[model samples]
Target chain A: MMMEKLTVYADRMSQPSRAVLLFCRLNAIDFEEIKVDISKRQHLSSEFREVNPLQKVPAIVHGNFNLSESHAIIVYLNSAFPGIAEHWRAKINSAMDWHHSNLRQGTVSYVINTVLGPATGRPLNPNAAAEAEKVLISSLSNLEDIWLNGDGRFLLGGSQPSIADLSMVCELMQLEVLDEKDRSRILSPYKKVLQWIEDTRAATNPHFEEVHNILYRAKKKFEQQRSRVAETGTEPSNKIGGHSKM
Target chain B: MMMEKLTVYADRMSQPSRAVLLFCRLNAIDFEEIKVDISKRQHLSSEFREVNPLQKVPAIVHGNFNLSESHAIIVYLNSAFPGIAEHWRAKINSAMDWHHSNLRQGTVSYVINTVLGPATGRPLNPNAAAEAEKVLISSLSNLEDIWLNGDGRFLLGGSQPSIADLSMVCELMQLEVLDEKDRSRILSPYKKVLQWIEDTRAATNPHFEEVHNILYRAKKKFEQQRSRVAETGTEPSNKIGGHSKM
Candidate 1:
């Protein structure tokens, strides 16, 4: 059977988008990556809306069948494609579902409210950031104590990294944009989780680092902006200012 | 090979729990319903923690393998058992994932903050309730305009109801506990959504009603409480009052 070519619509800066992209590259799945520049508000355009009515990255067009939501897309890809292992599906599904309201929700809320909001013209929301930090800390503890209880490096004790690992590590990567001290304070306690993140990166490298370049670049720019504020003895502007666009 | 009996830990009051129970009953999958009453805080008990360390309702023990997250549980059940249609898997997976951040998040927040918070001794937050309403309305619009755009009933236009339909409709049913005028005002705008909800309920039949009886009973109690407040010219107590426990 001739399979329809897979085209992924993603913004590399978005965590789930990076997961999908990294998954495809790691599996050697033949695909096209159509960059959906979320930082530029391109995802909300009508053109992209035709692909995903939710107006979110990353969505996928597998021939005529269009699918959105990262977990769903990856699960479908795993089932539809060759070479990926099947044994990981159920546990992977559990981890991904838990991710939404737990890690993904907290990390996304924390990053956007505390930092990225300014880049996008949404002002800092200290109350929301604080609440998100609490949720993130609790979720990290759960990840370490519950999910990573086993000796294996990857989630659910899989020797090979699963889609769940990719998705979750991508979420944690959002913390990179935080102030170094703040990021350390939040993540330093989760020793096992940090080890698992490194393990996942090692397992799916090159592509993992490749997809995350956007985030790393943004992180550097954010740090530079913060240091400038410190040197100038001025509060950072509500916006990212004219120069440093994410 | 003989399969181990499935045991589901659920509270009927929870939207996702009802979805899981209704799915099992509709599919005639042999299972034991072990009620983990959230209102009574049984889900938080150390015993329940053995079933699901996350301490959330709607966990399942299928033989030795325990799974939490209703979407994962239902999808695993659909696969591990017979009688479920296979074609619905990808679309159903997409809908369930989309539900987490959109419909499920918004509806749960709106209900908890606006109504159910007090039942559990958590005071209502008018700000959160108002914010949740905005999200709920936007989600409903997306449901009407995007998901239910097809001629056939249910999400993604399947003739038979999918897990997605059951989960989403169960979430909407939370509104039943709100004041009648508020419920109508919130729901009436999306004519197609209301019809789709009915279609889902009809497709699931006697089981839907059987499981939703808990919600229906709670609805009646909330209404009576409201009427008493109106007649006596007293602000409805922040609590649901001692006599009416959900």
Candidate 2:
């Protein structure tokens, strides 16, 4: 089959977007990346609204199918491109579906709502943040259980990397950036999960220079905010205290 | 084929659980309903945790497959019971997948975070509410566009209702109950959506009565809180909101 041109609407820092990017790379699906400027609120702009009114990242324009939602996009990719590895595709689908309701909304939302709120100087709603953290801890604990009990090194039964591994690793990476304590909590108990992340990274092509470029830009922004706080003689807003008892 | 017994862990007021009930009623999938007491937080109990450690409702245990997440459960139902209108199944699957990450999360979260919060005298986070409303409005607008422009009366092209209609109707109903003004907004422009709800109700069996019971129960709880606020100057401590917005 002739390769169709795929345009992925994404920001590299977004876990969902990373999931799609990694999926495309693994499947060897020829695609072009269109960075949606989430910082400038371009996603909500009229021009981009024409593309996705929902204004969320991880959208795709493939031929006649203009799809949003990372899970839908990945599913469409797997169904449309049949020549890719079957086991990997199935595993990715299962994990992506699981992540949508469980980890993404559950854990990732926790980090963004709680830790990232103070980081960005957004008014942190303590009640919502606490609820989010409760959900996040449960989700992370579940991930540990699944990783410990599951038959494969990755989430599903496969030796090669899948979209599941990609989606999960990105979310965990976000969690790591949010709180160093959380990184320890997630990794220390889940030995297989830690190993799996390393394995998946090694198995895939590390040519995410473009991905790193986006991350570097975000880091620069973070540093600027820190400097502003320092100059103002204000306590750093983003820092979280030690982990609380479950 | 002999029908597989399905056990649904649900509460009637929950939008997602209602979606499951609607699916079973439409597809003639026989299942026993196990209502979780949201008022008492029965979902958080350790026994229930084994079924879904996340402690959310609209989970299912069918044969050997134990699944959580409303979208996952609905998809599994469609897949397991192919007798439930195949064309409608595909359309419903696509629509549900789209809505899961978009409309469902956005609308449901907005309702809970904004309307329900103020009604319960909980500390209302206006920023979260505003952010939620932006997403909710866009989702509702897209829903209007799709229903108006799409190929069929229902979400997918079929005379009978599918899981998409079930999932959507439940979410819309939650939005409807949140506030009279918001309800008017939805009812005014979305005639087709209103029609879809009636059609879904009329086509399906009496299972919706159970759904109505749960909704009204929630409504009663909200009213009681209002009355209590009127009588005494203090707010209720254990105010249970609607669904998780998963």
Candidate 3:
């Protein structure tokens, strides 16, 4: 029962891309990983436009059918492969709705401004990052109160991880780059959510770490830059010039 | 085979709220509609927060179950009800994903900036509106190039309208307040999408018009304000001053 090899256009640094990549690997859904380096602006090139004219990455091309948006791609994959055993369909649907403006907004944009900005020459806008942090804290609160209510290890209170869990946790992990005080100040309040992050990583195993390697690297670079600024009072600019490294 | 009565929290003027209202009515899903007027800041009240802590309109509470986000609410209803003939589930899923950033971002944000701002004392920012229009036009172009490529009358090429049609067309209709020239310039080229808008309206008929009645009224007011401003060169400040009407 071999599935057709699906072609996934992704950049590991992208949060949703990691979600899609991890989903495929975890589900044993065979896919050819096409590295679309967003840092190189590869996603915006004309060739990538053929796959996703939206010019965003984490898209998929299955035969002639092209799909973009990590959520839709995951939904398509869930149905395309029979019996993935995600029993919390109702809760999963709710979580997706919650994810877009909540988790997706809080982590993704915050990281782009605070963590990824310096690397891309858009020096971190602290005001924007602060607003994003507020959003993330509120989002985590919502997650704790609603999605992760039960004692289950996942958002859906299921024994197994659902698409919602994968999509959300992937974005949340990007907070790793922030100074410990800032990250923990927002995240530490949500004990259950933190535990679930660990649980999700555990359940997804090697693939989770595989997809998130780029984020981990970025986090290290960000911390190093932060400490350098702290020590020498020197500008953190010019450390990672050019978009190719993003 | 009567189902438990559903309770929907919505505001007529909110685009997604209209989508949810239209969805329920179109599907003949009987529900009690609870008015949560954003203009009055009713949604932000502690009481309303009990229902949806986000305090955004268009949440539903069915029995003990609560849900938020118009897209997810509709998707859940589609599954909950038996034999609802809105086929093209796959295409519908794709459209929802596409609708969020593309249609929702462009149309909804433009309407918010251009149309709603003045009524609330925020005044129109032409630059922002122009930027939003470009986004809307680009979004429409993408729709024409991709979703409307087939011979289908509706988005999924189905005879019956799906939630995607309902949600997207509702958002698109918010463009009515734009200057006729501006609106036409952006929308006129896309004959297929225009026809689909017509098709969705026809399919969702009475309910569509019923739900969008507030929008049409708002459009009328906008036009009157523009004409009055043109004639008298007076400030368009005194029209509707308070939250009760919004």
Number of the predicted model whose TM-score against the real structure is largest: 1
User: What does candidate 2's lDDT look like per residue over B125-242, in tens digits?
Assistant: 7777777777777676777776434566666445656666777878877865554566676456766677777777776648665566667666667667667877996665554563
Pick the winner on DockQ between candidates 1 and 3.
1
TM accuracy, model 1 = 0.94
- Number of the predicted model whose lDDT against the real structure is largest: 1
Model 2 chain A lDDT-worst window of ten: A237-246
The regions of model 1 sitting more than 4 angstroms off are: A1-3, A233-246, B1-3, B233-246
Interface RMSD of the candidates, in order = 1.0, 3.8, 2.2
Task: Give each candidate's fraction of reference contacts reproduced.
Answer: 0.68, 0.15, 0.36
Q: What is the TM-score of chain A alone in each candidate?
A: 0.93, 0.80, 0.91
Candidate 2 residue-wise lDDT, A169-215, digit = tens: 77766664444455576457766667776776677656444344565
lDDT of 3 by residue, A1-246 (tens): 235668999988878899998988888887899999977889989999889877888889887778888988888888788767755566577678668767777787687777677667787788768867788888888888877886777875688888888889988888887777778887888899889999999998998888888777877777888899899986666544544433
Stretch of 10 with least lDDT, candidate 2 chain B: B85-94
Query: Which residue pairs collide in model 3, if any?
Result: A39-A243
